[model samples]
Target chain A: MSDSDSPSAITWCAIIAATCLLLFLFQQILWLVVPFLLALALYYLLAPLNKKLVLSGLSPDFSAALLSGAFLLLSGAALLFIYPIAIAHASEWQIALLRYLEGGTRAIEGMIAMMQDKFVFLRDSDISNDARQNLMNFAEQFSDKHLGKVILTIAAWLPSILLAPIITYFLLKDGAQLRRFIGCTVPNAFFEKTLYLIYALDRTARLYFLGLIKVAAIDAAFLTIGLWLLGVPSALILGIISALLGWIPYIGPLMGLTLSIMVTATDFPGDMVLLYWVMGLFGVLRILDDFVFLPYIVGKSMHLHPLLTLLMFFVGEAIAGVAGLMLVIPILAMVMVLGETLEIILLDTRLRARHTYARNLHKRAVTRDLNIS
Target chain B: MLLNLTGKFQAFKGTETPQLTTMRGITLFSQVATNELRAIKGLLHRRTYIKDEIIFDEGEKGQAIYFIIDGKVLICKQGRPQDGAIAELGAGQCFGEMALIDNSPRMAQVRAAEDCTLDVLFREDFLGLIETHSRIASKLSLELARMMGERLRQTINSYVL
Candidate 1:
């Protein structure tokens, strides 16, 4: 018989199709919902403080605003306080990088000649025949096409980048009302449970995600400052670049370590000192992040398998590029919350109906006895 | 406006209104109405009856329509079971509307089947409910008449069938 005629198979197929259709329809509302999810996470984390503030005679809204203001002050104060040091570190590293590039070109020429003959290097590498020919062409093309626009684009996007705190502030202030609004939108049959799941997943996402951002920033700072102090030329520049790469998770830190080793090796030939020092620093940090930081930060919020987490990251990267990778975990967390709640609601309804049926049957039996008597 | 909130309601013998809210999003009008109806239910005084208590004997003036909000009240005519049930109802149902509207005497005996609650909407309250929810009242009237008609036919046909 056709599967359509078979009972169980048809129901399964129907359910899957319906779920996909619902996902597509609700895609636009995800953005509005996402910030509130973060708000709820902050709400949970900051709730005890909020409650104490309430006991001290503050309204809920005022406490929310004060806490939000505190968070903003911390972030803004951080940018203000840390930026000058970071910029100095970056400028010093930049100068060191220019010096490295000058000497490194000669070292590259030697490597290219060796690679072209023995390593079967790409054709662009064999600059031996006319090494002087390409320098002007490369510089001219780079300036004309890419350099200025990159600087301009970064400046243009800076203000919007600063808007995250503003968004966080509003989310904190109105987060509970926002949740209730969303809850009200759910059919009453599923409202309370659905809200619970969303709140749970939201807390998990904040724990894992907000913690990772801090970890990445700290890693970048550690490497940059260490490189600067090591008297390693261009140390700060390379440190940040490597740390940013390491933020990619498992495979990334390996790439970062290799890059740091390669760059440092060139600056101080056979200077195993810089290479091993940087490696050990990152290794210890990584251990802290993976063990103490990650567990406490992300904890059991998602309950996703490691393999699934990796898969989601890659799929997210493929679809949305860099922003995709940053966003997918929270989005996945949200979908999980919704799916779990929907299942519970469906199960509850069926159970209730069964209960009512049994009650009706009992009433019928009672009626029969009365008639007999 | 369908039912007055101030007047007392005649009930069975000893039952009272239970304190509960109906679950939400039930598509049935009866379910939604029951929840809204409870807001005015406090003005509705209740009484209960034992299993064999005669709620109303036949030929008595039917001055009110008893709402069986919970438990069953049996409608036993002098002779029949099926014909009697057609005149009675359980939770979320009501009866005695004919006398309620047209000023007639009770056509059948209403006795308590168990300890039961009846929210009796007297002539004034019954008319108030009909005025407020004419649509529900009309739907109810049609269904009630259809049921009584079906029972009359069944009893009339019993001689031959």
Candidate 2:
């Protein structure tokens, strides 16, 4: 058996403590970690382009610079053209939201009035009074607390956004040297396995990020065309929002659909037929996403069980909110791959023999010391 | 067949001038073109091992084929010095070629018989090359099959005698 297969209570305690310590350190440096992870994702997406360029006779530095230049140009174009239209649509949506809320309040009041007229007992009931008060309190708290905090967080993250492109460029430029440096650190016994694991992780992350970009683009295009056909205002903006939110897996697409429905309902208030059509469109798209796009594009890289996935989703949500929910699956998948690779290395007879030999040598030394004393 | 084997051994023995030239002399890579060899050079990892240093232990997972650049290597079933040694390969010879076909445990322990310089070709890189350059992969694969077949025929003849 491998030395790691059996551990005393003290060993278990030490392991747990070390894990907790690492987690605490991770939490403290999360600001750095978040941007680094984003940069790594970007690196994975852009590295293949750089490699292709280099393979075609361009120098590595030049290839990386060219890709970075292209990205900057694209971002500049989006800021110049798309940003203004999105901003204008956002303002329009804000106004529409207030109008919808006002209409909703009036409808609720009318329902309460009719209920009071029909049932004299409910007019004097504390339950009805409490429900109304609770709804008002919840809405006030959401606006005052959640919305402000979200805005503040985004403002804080603005500086970190600049780090991503710079990190991605360096990763593209010196990726081979960096990989070799890491490989050098691995023990000779586990070198091949470690290299295999690193390659597998790189492949998985690259495939996932590229697949996500493709899926997002397809989703955005499909939604924009469908919304335009349904005569929805600001279809482009709504489509972009849907595409961005679609990163969050099960919860994100639903949130995107609800937001689209709300905006559609506000623009064409009391049009029940139009609302039904929008809902139908989202349902059809959801089916397509689940059955076709996810299976075909994303492939079966994540071999996680559905129950474990849901549990992790809830745990992730509890720990880091929406970001956690989006990152959890990929992180878990990587961990699974790392664990399996390590298990193979650990189970190898030579590695186990080495461990056994070391343990025996230590034991013999300890016994000799005791006898000498 | 004996004369042909002797002639090939003599060729290897005579051409120990440079590692790259000797690599071409090896039967497994004899058919590979110069441009293909240049491409394959990028995947080769060169390492120097001192005398008596263990290259790899028996029953350990093997993922690379090693080409002898200089000096000699001992292939033994057990780790102890000269215990059950099957071969003492010199410069221009290669070992662990079976690893290129499958990621199974090493059948024999490999140790440096003298100070040795070797080029290692890992299976992952080999697989990657197969995906990108099918022509090179096919040529190498064909040569490897022929080498294996020759060895199998020799082993069967020895057993019959």
Candidate 3:
């Protein structure tokens, strides 16, 4: 272990505290960091296409603008269609939640009584009847106070939301220029090696994010159709919700599974076949995710050990819950890559100016000796 | 096998870029301040070149200024009537800029030392821009004067040394 002396420890503590305090104070900036980072990520992803487009007679500005416009229109159209449905479903889910909870509680109590021992799922976390009622009342009161403002806030940010494509357009346009600008900034000695590291990290980030998207899409397809077949109402809705939530690693899938089971119970009530099928199908998809999906898709590039992944997930959850869980692994990958780059840059003086100069001098001296001989 | 890694090859691994490193900043807009550069960079034209490819040869008539966005470029003059290369261009420095003001033979040969990309603005269009915005003429003229002064100073220093 790298133990620190008292003075160093104090310094370290101060550093960490300052960092955390800065992060806490600049939470909005942190959100902006995601979008900016995402824009860079988008820049990388669309670089090849933009290059091709430029080569094919479209100007970079035109290419970036055109592509950004198309993307914005598509996603905007999607959100425009999807938002109202999602909001409606969400409201319906919330209102019916009491009846659902009450029904779910009674059903669970019944199942526990019926099984008497076997089913481990519904045997725990029994909210008391009076407590459950109070909770429902509280939920209603909270919704009454908060829901309108929440909807309005999301709706009000429409203009800003529309600005994303414009931001994306500039990123794609300047992306190549920015990258080259960074390269020109590198010293001669370490430029190639540094470029290599950047290239590797860029490749890894692109692959992992793209793989996640692919897997999520597949997961959505399988879950939605499967749910529909099982006669589970709002299968598309649930599937999409599950797909979105499932980005949260281990916790997300389990949460999705529990909710699906609960919803199934509300309608079907006692249908074990459909329940097993849903569980079993999801179980297989997950197994496929671990065994088949990830190996080929993201592979070991996101090679945090399970122990590390779990730790990161929880730590992220602790900090910012689901959003953190989704983002932390990618962030961890970035940090690791950055750390690696820093180590190479800082520790390896052979790659720096003085060393490079010395090497050149030595080579020249050796060449002179050879000529003299 | 890794011989000839020099001669202005791509940057090495484990390198950090200097803050003031001059990229091949293509400046067709002299009237456009640093402020405007930030805003209108979105509208610039971008181009790319492979390693060792000629961007524009020395004394070749070309009409565009080039920005060194990534990779490496060698701005070499056929030293004193085709003797040898005199200088290498790195990132963040602008070149072919004089063309935006005047359509003349290139002063030096520009080549990509590595796979490079550049944002280019053509002289014809840029001059048209200058024509409409006459304020640009004054500003650009001042800039051209400053650049010429720097060049003259460098030349004097070289001859004196």
Error of 3 at B136 (Å): 40
TM-score of each: 0.48, 0.71, 0.57
Please provide, for model 1 over B130-152, each residue's C-alpha lDDT reduced to its tens digit, 9 standing for 90 to 100.
65445445554565676567767
Worst 10 residues of 1 chain A by lDDT: A1-10
Candidate 3 error regions (>4 Å): A1-28, A37-52, A79-142, A145-163, A353-373, B1-161
TM-score of 3: 0.57
**lDDT assessment of candidate 3:** 0.62
A-chain TM-score in candidate 1?
0.61
User: What lDDT does each candidate get?
Assistant: 0.56, 0.70, 0.62
The DockQ value obtained for model 2 is 0.09
Q: Quote the positional error of residue A338 for candidate 2 in Å.
A: 4.1
Candidate that would win on DockQ: 2
lDDT of 2 by residue, B1-161 (tens): 97975675445434333555667866667887654665565567666666666778887667788888889999998667665888899887788988999867898888888878887778877886787667778998998888788879988999999
Task: Report the TM-score of chain B alone for all candidates.
Answer: 0.56, 0.84, 0.65
TM-score of chain A of each: 0.61, 0.74, 0.74
